[model samples]
Structures are given as structure tokens and as C-alpha cells.
Target chain A: MDSSLGGILSPRAIRDDGASMRLTRTIGLAATLMLIAVGLVFLRAEQTRLAKATLALESEWVHLRGERWALQAQVARLRTPAQTRGRMAIFGVALDPPRPASPRTPLSRLALVP
Target chain B: MNTRVDVTQRRNGTVVLVGIALLLVALAGRIVHINWTLHEKLTGIADRQQSGSTIIPHRRGLIFDARGRMVAGSRLVPDVFVDPLLVGDVDALAQDLGARLNLDPGKLADGIRARAGRRFHVVARGVDEVTAKAVREMRNPAVGLTMRSARTYPLGASMAHVLGFVGRDGVGLEGIESWHNEHLSGRDGRRRTIRDAARRALHGVEGGAVRPVDGGHIVLTIDAEIQAAAERAVENAVAQFEAESGVAVVMSPKTGEVLAMVSWPTYDPNRFGESTPQQRRNRVVTDPTEPGSTFKPFLASGALADGVLSTTELIDCGMGRRYFGRRLVKDVSPHGLMDIKGIITKSSNIGMGIIAERMGDAALYDIMRRFGFGERLGIECPGEASGIVYPLRRWTSMSAASIAMGYEVAVTPIQLAAAFSAIVNDGVYVAPRLVKRLLTSDGTVLEQRNSRPPPRRVIPSDVARYMATELLVSVVANGSGWRAALDDYQVMGKTGTAKLPFADRKGYEPGAYLSLFMGAAPARDPQVVAVVMIRRPNPSIGYYGGQVSGPAVREILRETLAYLGVPPDGTVAMTAAYRSRPGL
Candidate 1:
């Protein structure tokens, strides 16, 4: 009685049962692999972003340093003794002579009763 | 049988599960190590990438005169910079900046294009405060203003020789500034900053910092008021005489400190580049000339000190000419028979020749060396020449006679002045000095330069006193230096009119002579010794040292005496004694 019942079973039902089990095993493996690949891609994108940021900062540093050098040179030129004297002359400044008595006797003592 | 089989399977499953758990734990340990290592590397890279802020320069130190008046110093000026990348309307910006800053449009354009993408380039430098304010008000985003110190000289053209000028690079080119460059320049400071990708300064980052050390200040011994007076006197004399060049030096006889040293045809330190080499020279120290009759005093002192001649001893000048071998030494005029005092008073060439023969060349050369002739005064100023005074061994028969009359010997004005000062200061020869002292920023005397030795006695004090008395008589009675005589003071001095030797000319060009007057006032005890020399005065008025360079000494003395407040020696009789001498 067992052999006659088995022989009467449909081919579609047998194929469906084998196919569903194989699909389940394949789907489980694919899902696990997909999760690992997604994690790696996210990490790679973050690293690339950080590298660009660092490069940008270096460029800015270079620019700032250049500015500082130029400014410093200009300041040095203007503060030189020759140029300063020229500017003062344009402004009409004069030097006062030394008061021979300043260092010797005080001016008060040198003054006469007249 | 079923129970035994089920128990065996369960044991195997448990062993497999334990193996998987251990592998997973090992993988987690590796990942954790990698993350820690990566974090460290990333942090280091980020730190290296951080930007720093621009450095700002500090002001330089100030240079003041002896009176604490600002002479060479720095003043704040505006500097303009542009970020070419941010600049708009390039032509308009160029025109505006060029107009305001006095920059050429073409130069401005080239500057902007030179560093097109650069964050900052100097658009204009050293703009006045008012102009800088105007630029700031323009409110251009591309333009930036920086306040910087520019060196300024308040006294223009007056003390140019001593003060010196700075180059475009802010370094001293000549004079005192050049000599003390390191002490007069400041150390620059720096600042650091962190910036983002857009070059915006980031806060909370370690700001790098360095403070600037300002340059040391200098205080000169020159008196500006006297300097002006001296300059004016020299200029007026130079113009009036139509002289090629001239020099005047006012010095303190006791200290050997130079108060005012003026050389005519001088250029302003501010416009040094535009001046000729002749104008740039400090003739007082650099140029050597035949001192003419001025050399007679030193010779006379040597003769007196060596006991070769007495002040009262007489020498004969036969009709202005004396034969030395085949050479004829001619006096400017026939001085007739004269004593040592009379010889100097008349500046008689034949009279000096007689004294030279008695003293001999060796004794005279030794005395000249002791008086700092033929040597650099060792002053701080550069380019001082060692004047030419030949040794007695090199002297020919003619050389002795010529040197006696102030020829065959060349001396700088400084050396001449120093020697005269020594003679009048009781035979004590003091080395001349320009710098008085060096001071710190807080007015502390860092160093005092008064370590010079007491003057060496070159002549007897009594001899020097007698010579001073005689010199006073010369000025008051008949010497060419009479113009240098003071109103209420006894002035003693000599006059020199040496014919300039030309490479290609005949009969000395009639009027080409170095007119010189070397003198001291308050003859009883001299305080100031002044030397004035005028070169190549036009022959229109019988050019002589007495006629050309004399009045300058008078002007200087009058002003200097009033300024010094030295009471006049009312004893004018000393001058009368020389006037009563026989055969004047």
C-alpha cells in the first residue's frame, strides 16, 4: 500500500519542494554577503571624504604662508632708515641742537641775575 | 538503541559550534587593531594639514639726538595688499590704487597679474596715514590694510653725513645707522592658525605665537641747533665764496667730542641716491689737504717743546724769500725780522723755515705724530683717511723747508682740529670721539664711552699757554684770522692760504687755494676749538683763508658762546699786547 501511494504523487509538487529549499539556501547566503559588501563601501566613502578634507587644509595653509611672507617683506622695506628719513623730510621735522648746559650745569644755575 | 545515537550527534554539534565561536572572536580582534592604527594615522595627517595665521611685523626702534629729540625713527604707515582671486574691476582697482598710492597703473597691473591666483599680494606700500584711511573707507573686499612702521628722519639735510640713510630693504646704507644696524633693527614675530577648506580661520586650534623684540635705540652726541648753525654758516660761505667745497667742525677741547661737523655741498640723507660722490663725503674726516700755515703751529710747538727755540727768540725773514739749496721758500709777505710769536702771527714761510732748521726734521715729525697727524682719529665714522705726514728720513732739503711752511704735508680737517684742540688744552692730546653713550629702551646707560685715556702731554703747559696767548694776539692784531675774534672774549687762531696744486693748470689759477682758519676762544682757558676750511674760492676778492673762511668762524663763535653761556673774559688787554708788537 505504501508503494502504490507514492507512485500516484504529482511531478509538480516534487519539483516545487526541491526548488523552494535550494532557493532558501541561496537567498540566505546572498543576504549575508550583501550586508558585508555594503559595510565595506560605506567605510571606503568615509575615508575618501577625510582625505579630500586634509588636502584642502594643506592648500589653505600654503596660501596663508605666502600672504605672510609678502606682507613681512613690505613692512621691512618701509621701516628702513633711509625711507623713514625721506618721509620725515616731507613732513618738515627738524632736529634740536644739544643744550651745552644740559649735561654740564643745570640751566637754572647758568642763568644770570639780569 | 535510539537514545544512544541521539546523544552522540548532540556532542559533535556542540564541538563544531565552539570552533566557529573562537574564529569569530579572532576576526573581531584584528578589526579592532586596524581601526586603532588607522585613527592614529588619520589624526596625524589632519594635524599636519592645519593652516597657520599670518605673521605681523613690529615697529623698529627710534634714534634720538643728544637732546632726546627724535632724529632717525619709525612712524606707522599703511600697507595695502590685494587678493587677486577676489578682486573685481581690475582696471578700476588699479586706477584707484595708483591714484591714491602714487603707483603707476602699469606697475599695479603687473603686480596683480604676477600672483593672479595668490591669496595676497602687495598692492602698495608705505602709504600715509590719511591715504590709508581713505583706502580703508573705500571698503573694497579684495584690498587689505596693514599698519607698519616706516623709518622717519625729522631733521632733513642738516646732519645727513652723520645720520645716514636706509635702503629700500630697510637696511642702513651709511652713517650711524649702518654702523649700528643690528642694534637698531627689531626681531619679527609670527602667528599660526588652522583653516578650513575655504581658507577660513578655525577657532579653538592652537594659535602659534611669537613676540617681536624691538631694536635698540641710539642717542647721538650731536647738538642739532649748533649743527644747523654750522651748516648755515658753511653753506653761506660756500655760496658766497663760490668755493668748490668746504668743511667746518666745532669741538669740545676738553672732551674731544664733536658738537657740529658740517661739510658744504652736502646732500640730504633722505635723497642720498640723488647725490654725487663729492656731496656724500664727510670732508672733515675723509678729505686731506695741505693745511698751509695751519701746520706752522704744530712745528712751532715742536720747536718750543724741544728747547730748540724760545717764544721771544728772533728769526729773520729776508724780503719774503729764503734759499734752501736751489729752492726759494717765499712767504706771503715780507715779515722782516720776527720772534717765534711774530712768526706764527704773520704766518711767515721764511720764519717757519728758520725754526724748522733749528728743530730739525726728526723732532718736528715726532711732534706731529704725537699730535695725531698722519693717522686716522679712529672715530666711529667710516671712510676716515690716514692723512699723509712723511717721516724725517724721507725728507729732502726742500721737503724740510716746504713742510715748515705747511706744504709737503697733508692733513684731514678732523686731525687738524684734534691737534689744535690738544695744543690749546694745555698740551694734552685727547683722541676725538663721536658717540657719547649707548642707552637702553628704559633710559638706562648700557655703556658709557668715556674710557679714553687722559691726554698725553705733547708740550709743556706753560708753552701751550704762551702759544695760546700769541695766537690770541694774531687774531686781534694783524693775522688773517682776525674775523674770528669775539666781541668780549679773547680769541686765538691762525690763518692758512695754501695754493692748490693742479695736474693741468698754470700759475695756481690765481685764486685756487684752501682757505683755512683754526682757532679757539676765551684764550686764558680755551673751551672750544673750531676749524673752518673753504676750498677754491673765486679770486674776485683776493681769496685768502683770512678773507674767505674767517667770517664763518666768527659766526659760529658768536652763536656758540651765547648757547654755551660761557661768560666773556673781560680782559681785552691780552689782545692789546700783540697789537703793540714792533714792526707790525
Candidate 2:
């Protein structure tokens, strides 16, 4: 009889044990939800940072393309015949002007006296 | 009394609990309805706020001369515009823009005022790098800069007629530009991107981009060196003689490739708006003229081919003048009796008239048609004229004689050049070609799906060779075209001086003349055929084709032959058999 009494539990004690278990479960669920929310926010921030960097790089690429075309145009202009002739004149190798077929005839036979 | 109060308290607590439960139920139902019924709509709104599309600019093709020199290219330049409605302190804005763009501040302000309500206005177009940088540094929200691709011609006015020009809307308007616009203009690309709150593209979407296709490159058959020489010679000749205008065409007699074509009074295609339509005209292919004595060689060849006359056949030329069917046919000078060779050397009209009378109208017309006259040669240019060839049905009583004298027929300079090319190209008529090949942007030649037609035979090979080597050579060696003889090479050619007809078709212009010279060099094995035509030289200076146009042809040929490194042959002497004796 004593052993039986020793093994028996009170309703108040059982009620207290159940309440503690429920409290523990509720706290674990809340912690897991908080962690998931923090993970989502961090991922969003990283995506935005990467997008901004890519935008800057793309802008630079476009600018470089424009620069390339401008440089090509400049090089072509420098290689033109007129520019080459000008450079030749800068040195001592200028081309001679064409000589007329006949000696330039006198524009007037005689000048008028003042 | 206690029991009654307890019951009332229980009733009030029950009522409050019921109200709380009902409100919770309504909130849960509303959440379900939004998640299920409006899901797609809400997602679309979010995507609209985050993503957008942008166009990637395309690059037009490049044009290179045969020497691989870039004659035309495309460049990116900033085109600045203003939003007048967004402008603040208009006077300050104008002053800032004027200082950078070299515009009058007052005028700019007035322009802005005139467009106050408008959202957009052009501030400047195609600004250079320095000016564009200054405007960008201003950082004004009211101003905007659009990067546009513009065409650039490195050779400028030197190749204006061949390279043509592009319009403000990126459309080809003239010359090779218009002819090959489809191959030269590439397709623009589109990219789907995620945008920021300010409507700027942040990053591209995955698999959402359509890449641009760049235009193909064009290689022309024009030799820049030869082209420059021809232009210089023609320009100098026109200026020397004080002529109205001039034309020069240099072509490869072996391949019918036009090396250089220059039309005097040319305009700078870069500033085409400042020039007149007359200056922009490509007269080499578009203008027609009576060939005069130049037509005599063709007549003689046709008569020889028809078996009506032989090179050694003799006929009497009466006192420098004769009457054929009431048509008075006169020569520049009288000749007694001569064969076909002497008649060509002396350029006798009476001799040509007698030969044409024997051939009759049908035979003569057939010969002219076979020579590519009175028809478009199908050259790769715009507005090629089919020149007048009055058909056999339209012939009057005097048509045969007049046609033989080169009076009734009109031919373009290119047509005449091609006809002469046929004679020099060993009897084959090869159409003239300008473009050599097309290349992809990456430098791979495209397959030739549209090759030129094969050369066809028009005259016998032996007959064509004899005319170019024997008869035409004599004309330059001792005949009227002696002025066209070059010092290093043996030149074979003919001369023509024809009266210009009035525009109204009433009669010939008073004292107006067209002087022309057509020739080929290294007579035995010809290389290049050059034709020079001078329009309306001062009659006082010289109106004869031999005097005015011959020297220009000589200069062009001299430069071209020297550049080509053709070895000089000793002077060509007339053979004793073909030389005109005092009394043949």
C-alpha cells in the first residue's frame, strides 16, 4: 500500500508539467520563425548590392565602347590624304606645284603709267 | 440578490467573447480571398515596378577603298536636347549652354521661351567630345543627352559622289550609301532589365537579351591613288580652260572595273546642304552628249564587220564636202582618195557618210545597239540615263548620214567608255563594276550570290584588236589626238567636238561646245581606258577636243601608268602598210 501511494501523482502537479511542456514548444516555434525571417532579409539585401555593382560595370562598358568608336574615327581622320600632305609640308618633302604646259604668258603687254 | 448579479455578469462576458470571435473570423476570410483571387494581379504590379526594357544601339558598316583605306565609318556622338517645361531660370540655363556650345545667349533664351510649354527641344546636334563633356558636367535635370551613331567620311569631298551621305534619322540618302543601305544598316537590340525607383536599369534579366547584329563592311574597286590623280587632273583642266564643268572616267579595259570616276563641281557630302543640286549631280552616268568624231571609229568597225567595207578599201572624198541624199556631208579638210584607215586618222565626215549609206539604216542601228548605246548599262548607281538612240522606225531621210557623223545619237560618258572598253577588251562587252566584295563585320567574305553577268562577245576578236592597235594608235601618233600622246606609253585614242543642244529641244546653243577625248594606254596589251570630257570651254581659248580635253587625258594616263609600274615602251611608229600615202 505504501508503494502504491508513493507512485501516485496529484492533478495539480500533472497540470503544472503539461503547462511547462506547452510553454517550451511555443518558444521553440517562435525562435525558428524569427531565424527564417532574418535569413530572407539578408538575402534581399545581398541581391540589391550585387545589382548596383552590375549597373556600374555596365555603364562603364557602354562608355568604353563609345570611346573606342571615337578613337577609330580620330585615327581615320589622321590618315587622310590632306592630313598626310600637311605633315609632308611640315618636313622638307613638299610636292611641287604642277607647271603649266606653256610658260605663263604676260597678263598684259604693257603697264599703264600713273 | 447575489445570484441575480452573477447571472448578469456572465451574460455580459458571453456577449464580449462572441464579438471577439466574429471579428477574428472576418479577418481570416479576407486574408484567404486576397491570396487566392488577386494573386496574379498583385504579382504583375510588383514586376512592373522592378523591371523594364532598354534598346542597345547598333553600329553601321565601314567602307574601305581598294587599298584598305577607310573612306566611311560610324561614330558615337552626343546629341543634346532640353526639356523646356522642366527648366528653371531660363536665362541662366541659356547662358550656361551658350558658353559651352558657342551659341548666342539671347537667341537661346528666346528659343526656350518660344517652347515654354513643350517637353523637348534640341539644344545641339552631334556635339564634339569637349562640348559634350562640358554639357554633361552641368548636371542640369532640364537637359538630356542622347548618344547617336553618325556617319563619318574620312576622305571628305574627294569621294563624295561614290560614298554618298546619310540623313539625320540614320537613313542612307545617296551614292553607295543608298544602294547598299540594307546591308550597311544593322539591327538594334533589346535587353530586359530590373530598374530602380529612378527608372535606371540596374541589372539584366536572365535569358532576356537580344544581341545586336552589326552591319557588313563594303570593299570598293576604286584605287585611292588613281582616283586622286584623276580628280586633280580634271579639276585643273576645268579651272585652266575656264570651262563650265568636266568629267573623267578611268577603267580597267581587261575587267571593266571603273578605277576612278570624277565629276567636276563636286560637293562635300559632309556638308551637302550647303551645295546646289547641280553640284551634286553625277554627270558621268546621268548626263548624255553627242559624241561627234568619237562615233566614227565605231561606224568604221561596224562597216568592216558587216563586210560592206574593208580596212584596205579605197573611196573618193570630194573636196572636203559631199552631198548624200540631199544631206551636205563635209569634212574638216578635203581628201582625194583613201582607205578606211586614212579616213579614221583624218576624221572625215564625208568618208563616214559614204560608208553608212552603204550599210543602210537597219545594219547601222544594229551595230549601235550591240555597242551598248541607247540603253542603260545597269551600273550600280542611281539615275542612269538610257540615252537617245532613235529606233529604225523613227529614222528620217537624213538619219543614216547624221547617225554616222555622231550628230543624231546621244550617249552618256560611261556608255561611251564601256563601248570603247569592248573594243579594247578583245571584243567582249563586260559591264562596269564598282564594288569588289562584301565582308561580314568579323572580316569573312560573303558568298557571291549576285555576281555580275558573264562578259559576252559583240565584235570579232581580230577586228576589235586591229581597231584599237592600228587605227586608234595612228590618231594619237600623228592625227588630231596627238596632244594626248604620253611620253612613256603608246596611247591609242580618238577626239570629239560636238555642239550643245538647247534645253527646249529647239536648236543648238550658240557657241557652246563639248570637247571629249577617249583613249587606252600601252596600245598592244591595253591596261586602262580613260575618257575626259570638257563642257563649254571658252571658244576663245580652244573648243576642239584635241586641244582642250587631250592634255587632261594625257596627265591622268601618265600618273596612272607610273603608279601601276608599267614599263615604258618605245614610241609607237605607224606600220608602212597602214600609213597614209600621198596618193593611195
Highest DockQ among the candidates is held by which one?
Answer: 2
**Which numbered prediction scores highest in TM-score against the true structure?**
2
Residues B271-337 of candidate 1 have per-residue lDDT tens digits of 6779988888888888898899889988888888889887677788889877986788887788788
What are the chain B TM-scores of all models? 0.86, 0.87
Q: What lDDT tens digits, residue by residue, belong to model 2 across residues B470-547? A: 789888987999999986578889999998999888789988999999999878678899999999999998989989
Candidate 2 stretches greater than 4 Å from native: A1-42, A85-114, B1-54, B83-122, B192-201, B205-208, B448-451, B572-584
- Relative to the true structure, candidate 2 reaches a TM of 0.83
Cα lDDT, all candidates = 0.75, 0.83
CAPRI-style class, candidate 1? incorrect
The local lDDT score (0 to 100) that residue A60 gets in candidate 2 is 69
Enumerate residue pairs that collide in model 2: none
Q: Ten residues in a row with the worst lDDT in model 2 chain B? A: B569-578
lDDT of 1 at B10: 82
